[model samples]
Target: MLIRINQDAHPIAPSEITPESLYRGRRNFIRAAGLGAAALAVSPAFAAAKLGAIQKSPLSSTEAPTALKSVISYNNFYEFGTGKEDPARNAGRFKTRPWTVRVDGLCAKPRTFAIDDLLKLAPLEERIYRMRCVEGWSMVIPWNGFPLASLLKQVEPLGSAKFVEFVTAADRATMPGLALPVLDWPYTEGLRIDEAMHPLTILALGLYGEELLAQNGAPLRLVVPWKYGFKGAKSLVSIRLTDKQPATAWNIAAPNEYGFYSNVNPEVDHPRWSQASERRIGEFTKRKTLPFNGYADHVARLYAGMDLRKFY
Candidate 1:
C-alpha cells in the first residue's frame, strides 16, 4: 500500500523548502497539515533543516523569530491597514492567483515573472534575524526565503543602476490600506545598489515556514532585517533599478520622520518615537533596540563615508 502524501501537510514556507528535503519528512506531518488543524505545518525533524532555533546573533534574541512567535505574531499584510490583526482578519479578500512581478530599468533582460517562477529560482531557507521597526517595536523573524540579491542579480544591473525600487500591488478595493493617501496608496521603497545586495535582505514569500497570507503582503514582500520595518516595503508588483533615488512612500510621508536609509539606529531617533527601545512585538515591547538591528558588522560598511544621521 502506498501512503498518500498531502501537499499542505508538508507545506513548508516557500523560502524554507529548498534548505531541507521537503519530501523526506514522515508522511504524518503532511497528513497533520491537511487535517484542518493548520496549513503548511512541518514535522519536528524538518524544523531544524534551515537555521534552526539558534539566534542569528546574541544581540537579537528578543528580535529573532521562533517557532511559537513566528506563527502567532507574524504576517505583516497591511493591505487592511496598520492593525496588528488586520491581515488575519481582513486579508482574505485579496486575489493572489494571477500574481506577477514586472522587472525593468537598467537591465539587459527585463521580464515579468510569475510568482511561481520566482519561487523555483531559489530554495527556501529559514533565517532567524532581528527585525527592527520604526514604531519602536521589533521581532526576531525566522524568515524563509533566498536573499533578495539573488533575484536582483538576475536582471543584471548596469553601470548606472544605483538604486532598487519596489512598487506595491495597486488594488484599492481589496487593499483598504490603499484607500488612504498614506504614501500614495500603492506603497514603494528603494535601496541603494550596495544595500540591495546585502546578504541579510530578503524578498520573502512567507514567514514561519508557510506561504505568506494576503494581509501579510501575500505573494511577495521584502524583509530588510537591519532597517526599520517600513523600509521593507510590501505587496511588491514592480521592481525598477534606477540611477536616481526613487521617492519611497515612508520617506515621502514625513521626510523628517523617515530617511532614505531608514537603518535601525538607536542613536538616531525617529521624530515621533525613540529608536533606543523597541517593543519586540510578542516580547512585551520593552526590548532594547540593537544597533543596525544586530547586523551592523555586516551592513555598516555600506555607510562608511557619511554620517547616518545626516543621510538618514
Candidate 2:
C-alpha cells in the first residue's frame, strides 16, 4: 500500500516521474544481490506508521513523490563507489549501527551523540524537497528528519562560530571508492552558520518511509535543498562549528569547478555544462532550472547584497 501525507508549504507544478532511473541505476546491484523488480517497492511498514508522529512543519510540495526505487537506487555517494550504482552494490559493507556524531570546535559544550540519541534530539518530520544535481539532473525527494539547526542548537554554538563543517565517515577497509583519488578521503563539507541554522536545512535520517540505505548515506546525512546535491554530505560523522570558512572536499579538489557555497544558480553555469536547464531523472526532456533550486524567495535573502556568481 502507498502512503500519502499532507504537505501545505511548497507549491510546484505537477511533474512527470519514472521508476526507470531508480531501477536502472541500481540494476547492477539488484542483479548481484539476487533481487528482482519485486524488491523495489519494499519499505518498512513501521517507518510509515511513525510518520507524522513528530511535530510537522507544514512543509510540502505539489510535485508527485518520485518512486521509492529511484529515490534509493539513483545516488551519488562516492564513499561507496563513484558510479550511481556503486553504493547499492558496495555500501552494504558499511556499518551504520552504533554510529556517533562528534560535535566539536567553537561550541560551548562539545558532545557526541549516538545515532539513536541523535534521532531523539528533535521531532522527525517528512519534508518533500527538490534535489538538483551539479551534473544537470534533478529529483524531487521526500526526506524524513529534523532540521540541522535542531542538532546544532543542542550543542550550543559559541558566538565566534562562523562556519559549520561536516565530515563524512571514511574507512578504507570498507569503502572501496577511497582507493581511487577522487576527492580527498573522509569527504568534508561546510555551510555558513546562518545557512546551517536555516529552517530548510535538515539532517535526513530516512526516506520513503524507511531507514537510509548505506548507499544513500545511512545513519546521518545533510539535506540543503537550496544548494547543489554535493553540498549535502552523506554518512556524516563529525559536525565541527568553526570560526573560519572550512574547505569542502569538492572545492579543495577542484577550486575552479566546485565552490564552497555551491548554491544552485542558473546564471553561473558550470565550466563544462549549462546550468540553465536540468534533466529530471526518468524524463527524456530537460526543464529550466530554478535559482536556488526554486527556493529563491525563501532563501535568496540569505545571500542579499553578495554576488552569487563570485561565491558560486
Candidate 3:
C-alpha cells in the first residue's frame, strides 16, 4: 500500500518540503496521495470514528462542525495576488483594519460598511461542510462563520433585485494578475438572489475558530458548497444587487465550460474532465461525487421543477 504522498520519483525529501508545500490550491495534496476510486461514498467522519479518539465537538450540541479544515490556508483570492498560497501570504498587505464594503444597486440599505461593523451584527456559527472543487479534488473543511442569508436580509433586497454580484479589490500594483485580460479583473462573481439567500451560501469571516487567514480571502469571502470552487469569491470589495443576472467571471469566459448555475452533478462533465468521482483530502482516498455535493437534502428544493443537466 502507498504510505506517502507525491508521484514524482525524485521527490524532495520530507525535511526539504515545508508546511506550505503540503498545500497549494487547497486540494492539490489529494492527488499526491493515492486517493483512488475505491472508497467513493465514505466521508472522513466515518473513518475517524473507527480509528483514533474522536475529537469532542468544539461547538454546542446545537451546532455541528462543517468538516475538518481539510486543506490549510490556501485560496484563489486574486486581489492579494496569484499562486495558491499568495493570497494567504500577501493578504495582510491589504488594509482589513478599516475595510469598507461598497453596497449599491437594488437595495434599501445602499451605503458603505466598515468591515468590523458587519462582523459585529451577526451571531456567528460554525458549519462543517465538504467542499469539492470542479477540478475533482475535495476537502472536508470546517468553516467557521454565520449564515449569509442573515446579511442579505439586512440589505433588504429590492423586489427587482434578481441577482447579487461581488467585486474584489483591484490595485494592479499589489495584484499582479489584474493585467491579465483572461478575466475581467478585480474578479467579479455573482449568484441569483435566490441562491444568494440559500442557507449554505456564506459570507464567511473566519475559519477553524480563528480570524480568516489572508490567503483564504481575508476580511470576507463567499462560500457556496454545492457549486464548484470559483463560485465562492474571496476578499470581497463591493456588492451590487442587480435587476438582471450579472456576468460572472467563469461563465463569461467559457460558457460551455461553466454554467450560470454550477451545481455539483456527478453526471455533468466539465469540458476538461469527468466529474463522476473526486479525491477527498485527509482520507487519502477517492470518493463518489454526490448530486449536489451531498447537500442535496438541504438544497434540492431550491432547484425543484428545474433541469440541472440543462443549467449545469
Model 1 residue 181 distance off true place after TM-score fit, in angstroms:
1.9
Candidate 2 ranges with C-alpha deviation above 4 Å: 1-56
Candidate 3 lDDT trough over 10 residues, lowest sum? 44-53
The clash number for model 2 is 1
A best-first ranking of the candidates according to their TM-score comes to: 2, 1, 3
lDDT tens digits, residue span 1-312, model 3: 437765697677878765774566444544434267322112211111111112222322232332433244445555555576655455434444557887788989887878778777576666667677888877666665666678777778899999998987777655556666757676788889888888778777766665565556666788898888888887788989998888888888789998888999999899789999997654566888998888888788989998888888
Error of 1 at 80 (Å): 1.2
Sorted by lDDT, highest first, which candidate order results?
2, 1, 3
Candidate lDDT scores, in order, read 0.72, 0.84, 0.70
- What lDDT is reached at residue 96 by model 1? 66
Better of 2 and 3 by lDDT: 2
Task: Output the lDDT of residue 235, model 1.
Answer: 71
> Candidates' TM-scores?
0.78, 0.83, 0.75
